[model samples]
Target: MKRLFYSSAIYTALGLLSGLFYREMSRANNFDGYSQLNVTHTHMLVLGTIMFLVFMLVEKNFSLTRHQKLFNWFFVTYHIGLLLTVAMQMTNGIMTIKGIEVSPAIAGMSGLGHIFLTVAFILFYILLNKSAFKNKK
Candidate 1:
């Protein structure tokens, strides 16, 4: 939870910075570059920060695995998806900053990230169920 609070704080700060610099960015030679930056900001905050907080809460409230295996798997998949998503998004932002269009690689990685995120969520749900059962026993 403390980690999450810090993450949220940083995310809010980034949002503020993005907003404050918007006008300046728009008037610059790289005006079009602002769009991808905004997008990456949203992606990082929404998934990397918010979703990670939710994952932490779930893990803390429920000791879902007898061993660390399931917990580690969940964390790994979640971070992999989150990192890939953010990286592709940042790459796309860089292209935008250079006035280039988004590439197919970005599109493909985004799709894969979505799939992995879904799978991660499913794993979390399964872990929660298992934990609940264990508690009952």
Candidate 2:
């Protein structure tokens, strides 16, 4: 529960900062075109902060740590996925604002990050089901 709450808090900070970054960077460059950074703030808040808040609640009700391995896997994979996706977005946004040519490889990597997040999401549901079905200790 503590870990989950801390993760949510950290993500809350990251989300706010990312939004500020997007606003300031675009303004500094006088950017008017759409960029992935436009959505980075939302992605961080939803995926990072909100997801973890829900996780903490799930933990309180279902004792997610009962299945420690699955919980750990879900936690690590989720972080990797979110960070990779957001990093790519920020990189692409910066490149766009600076008039640099964006590479296809970044998109490919971002897709991979989405894959990780999908897998993590599945693992999380599985964990939830497992805990919910378990007998009280």
Candidate 3:
């Protein structure tokens, strides 16, 4: 139940952030626009928060094989990825507002963050599927 509560909180926060970020980007009025903020935000919400919680529920209801530790690692890595991506994006937005070009460093961070998340998702899938369809009786 506690896991569900935290997961719900993450989802709610993710939705709020998505709406707010979308509004900011729409208002920016950048005509040359194909920003990854929307994509990144969606990935964070779907993979980082939603998937993590789903795994938490599976962990709660299943008999796992040392998978608990891996799930914790997934949680850490996923959040780290999200934090890096979001910080880079928010910083880029600030720079855009200040009339400064986006920094290559931030771009690199966002890219690496994406990779971390990809790996995290793979691990999450492996952990969840290992016991998701097992016979209960």
Candidate 4:
């Protein structure tokens, strides 16, 4: 629980910082056109902060930690994915603003990050299911 809360708080800070970065960077560059920065803000808030808050609620009711292995794996994989995704996104956004050519590998790694998040969610749902049923039977 504390872990979840801390994670959410960290993400909240990160989300706000990312938003600021996007705004300041764009303003500096006089850039108002499309860029990956646009989505970085939303992704951090929605996926990083809010998603963990939702999971915290689930943990309170479901005792997700009862499945210790799943909980640990979910925690690690979720962070790895979110960090990778956001880092690559911000990198691409910065590259765009600086008129630097973007690399294909960055996008590919971002896709892999999404895959990690997907797997983490699957583990979370499984933990939720086990916690729900373990209490029943």
- Candidate 4: C-alpha RMSD to true structure equals 1.1
Clashes of each: 0, 0, 0, 0
Off by over 4 Å in 4: 135-137
Q: Is candidate 2 or candidate 3 better by lDDT?
A: 2
User: How well is each residue in 85-110 modelled by candidate 4, as lDDT tens digits?
Assistant: 99999999999998999999989999
TM-score of each: 0.71, 0.95, 0.66, 0.96
Q: Across residues 1-137, which tens digit of lDDT does each residue of candidate 1 receive?
A: 45445755665665555545544555664465355556666766677667666755765777554446776687678767866776676677656766778879787997798888888888878777888677475
Ranking by TM-score: 4, 2, 1, 3
Clashing pairs for model 3 are none
Q: Between 2 and 3, whose TM-score is larger?
A: 2
TM-score of model 2 vs. true structure = 0.95
Runs in model 1 deviating more than 4 A are 1-28, 32-34, 65-67, 135-137
| C-alpha lDDT values of all predictions | 0.67, 0.93, 0.67, 0.92
Mark the 10 consecutive residues where model 3 has the least summed lDDT: 31-40
TM-score of 3: 0.66
Score candidate 2 by lDDT: 0.93
Ten-residue region with minimum lDDT total, candidate 4: 128-137
